[model samples]
Target: MTKKLLKSASRCIAALALTGAAGPTWAVESVKIAGFTWPGYGFWHIAAEKGLAPDLDIQYQTIEDPYESFNLVAAGQLDVVSSTAEFTPVGVERGLPVKLVAFGNLSYGTDKIVAGPGIETAADLAGKEVAVLEGGLAQIYVAMWLEQNGAAYDSVTYRNIIADDAFAAMIGGGVAASEFWEPYGTNTLKALEGASVLAQSKDPYWLQSGVIADGHYMSDALINDRRDVALLTMKAMYDAIAWWKQNPDEGNRIIAGGMSMSLADVELVIGKNGTGLDGGLYVYDFMEAAQFCGSAPGNPPFDQKNGQINDHWNLVSGWWVKFNLIEAAAPPETGIDCSLHKELYDSGYRG
Candidate 1:
């Protein structure tokens, strides 16, 4: 079925289920969520398809531009957004009514900085144009990599382009290097004769930095007026993750079908195996994520300290300030709401 038809059918099913047509009638809270077309954000579809949160109606929509998603949430049109983890600081700085409530997943080796032949290091791209989605995580990744490798962040010119355009630019020799996620990075190396991956998110430094990650964000209206619904929505996400881990193939199919992506492409980023694959993403389960948010009692996995969410926020905020995307770094509490995670843990919920 077409995406429009699928969404229509989902709404119809939700309505029928809520009206007691198939079973008992109960209060069903409807949540409107928006995100770009990325596999990490596709789990909500799984939650809805598997009836993970039968009490909540999840209406997931694909909005290619994340800034627009944030704007919609801020305007009370959207209740939740699954997007890059770096944007909450910008939202808080701009006074947007949104808070990141969960650290969803980290890019293992999915995100890469690929460079053309002879550009062996970050310094080689100095004064040359590098394609990136301006003000997005790609730009931040490239800038951070550059600064870490003895090159100044401002030394290179950033060409504002989407991933598809950036791929074409890389293949057409239009840019020296560009940051890409998943299949783009893989495809670039295969299609371009001499392209090389200079850095990947799974590298020791990037992994420890927790820079290239995805998260769940919700509007203040939902948190303030519909707190229970917000908590259930968060629970549904991790429930989806747990379900996916137990049933990888079927779960991947659900995500692939929901996102209108090829099964191979979905596997390329999220992996077909139940474990965290070498070139795929690292999905955080409920407890690990809670610890990362400092809501649980233990340290997070991957050598990351407990309550690393604050450090992650500060790191991204500092970069945003350097990028001139924000005037100054906002306090972590202004952008992150960890109470939901804390509530889940304190209630002895573990997944």
Candidate 2:
């Protein structure tokens, strides 16, 4: 399973025009966000709970299914969404009025490929029934592992299932292997006797590979009309990140409560699972994110090609076409827009 990873504009000119021809209209004062049940995306809750963006009247909700959130945004019911970054290209292909605004976190050690007893290697996964959230990062994940280990990509049967269900299936004797993110992956390892992790995102190879990330995406309605709202939203995110950095323990509790996950689960997501593999979510703090936004001197080391979003945008868009996950390749610009982040960073906002 992959838990993967907004707006505004005009007015004054039209107000002056009202004395002559016409008046301008402003965007909504409220910001409604739909996010998934992942700790990385939980910062929105912190932003809302702590009144980080009080002027925007920010409201956030947790929707377990990512597609539901995308649909809601497409239908104009939501202003923005926090989801896996891979879907941004898919959304653009389908003509969804969405653009990736800022990245949330690197999967780091979160995404994992776990196999039941008796499967020892990626090649051993051949002919096994592998469960993954189809068309999402999970499939890409398993495929990358298989390819890296010299296994045929089509060697196994691919079952499209959510991570939680896949975990249940793995436990109940259906899937021989499944891709999962923590704490599901950790929980599965603890629950099943002899089950082993086949591949982990935290592994040096995958971490340096720059294959996956989580992000925040906004609708055109939000980006085009309410840019002020969008900027404020990004500021709130950095503020939340800063707050969490200074108060990790309390922040984890807030994330757990807001995400409806247990504190242990939050710990697992934050890389406190004690696996000692440098695992856990690599949440970029304000300065780090600004650098990743290409707004600073040194970009994140994960992708050295510049930053996480740019590299993955190029990588995923190509892979999506190669895998036929999308009809054709969409321009990286169509899916990702880091200008908002640059604007905020340049403003010298401490948080």
Candidate 3:
């Protein structure tokens, strides 16, 4: 389930915390986190492998859906979560008390719209059905792309299929075309015959220059109350990213094993995304990372330097409120706490 409604994430987080198995040690309160099977979350895989978290023990569980992840972190069952852009706003709106610590990756050319043999153009999809993980970021992007191309969202019959599930159905002719997030999108393109690129998040026509797909997030309570841990984790994350750059093949292998995909397929997915295991800005220089993930004018989804929310994030929040995606009574921007990332970035810790 791309955005499949599941109840296991938080439950798992709570269970892990209670078990206190974040690591083999207990001095600093090891952090337990649940991430999905994407390139971005593999940072933990890299970190844990390198023993970067000597004082910290972070247990990593790769959940497949974002919906479950938000509630898990919000419930304090999990210390951190890496979520997509749409889900974060939903979390905030529902008053889950989540915070946007840093973006996992801005969707460059990663997320894609692939069409099976018969379809050639977006216009050809006017009367045809297209598969998209219902209520997911892919659905939103596909709908928006159709709208931008002089068509209504209703132009195509939208299917409520997850990326992997959609791949199966697409092979069976359940839908002529579909849009899905990366790795899956890349996988679909390779599995299907004669598939053509209908669109990708990296396309310039995409709103926000395709910086709309936020790949990760965390909990505000944890960030505010247990900040020392957050900084240590961030530093470990940076180290992991650096290690990933020097070891893409190994990192991809580990990620592939975790995600249940073939090593070759994982390579393709990472290649498509352009970053793979070390899949982020890297903040190669800690001095710059503070600014990149900080509350400065350059900070994403908000202009901390300019005293405004990152335009991209604010746009998503406003869109949710305008479209009523959250509960009818929910405030779109209510749950997000950007200052958490800002504070973390500014508090003397470089990475």
Per-model TM against the reference: 0.92, 0.87, 0.76
lDDT of 2 by residue, 1-351 (tens): 133210112354545577575444445468899888888888887777887776767788888788899999889999889888789888888888889887678777888899999999877888889999888888888887788789987788889976779889999979999999887888899999999988888777776765667878888888878888888878888788877776777777888898889888788777443222244788866666666657655766665444556777777777777678887776678888887777776787646
- Candidate 1 runs further than 4 Å off: 1-24
lDDT of 2: 0.79
What does the lDDT read for residue 290 in candidate 2? Answer: 62
Q: Ten residues in a row with the worst lDDT in model 2?
A: 1-10
- Indicate the residue-level lDDT of 295 in model 1: 92
RMSD of each: 8.2, 9.7, 11.5
Clash count per candidate: 0, 15, 8
Please tell me which predicted candidate would have the highest lDDT against the true structure: 1
Instruction: Report the Cα lDDT for residue 129, model 3.
Output: 81
Residue 282, model 3: Cα distance from true site in angstroms: 9.3
lDDT (C-alpha) at residue 104 in model 1? 89
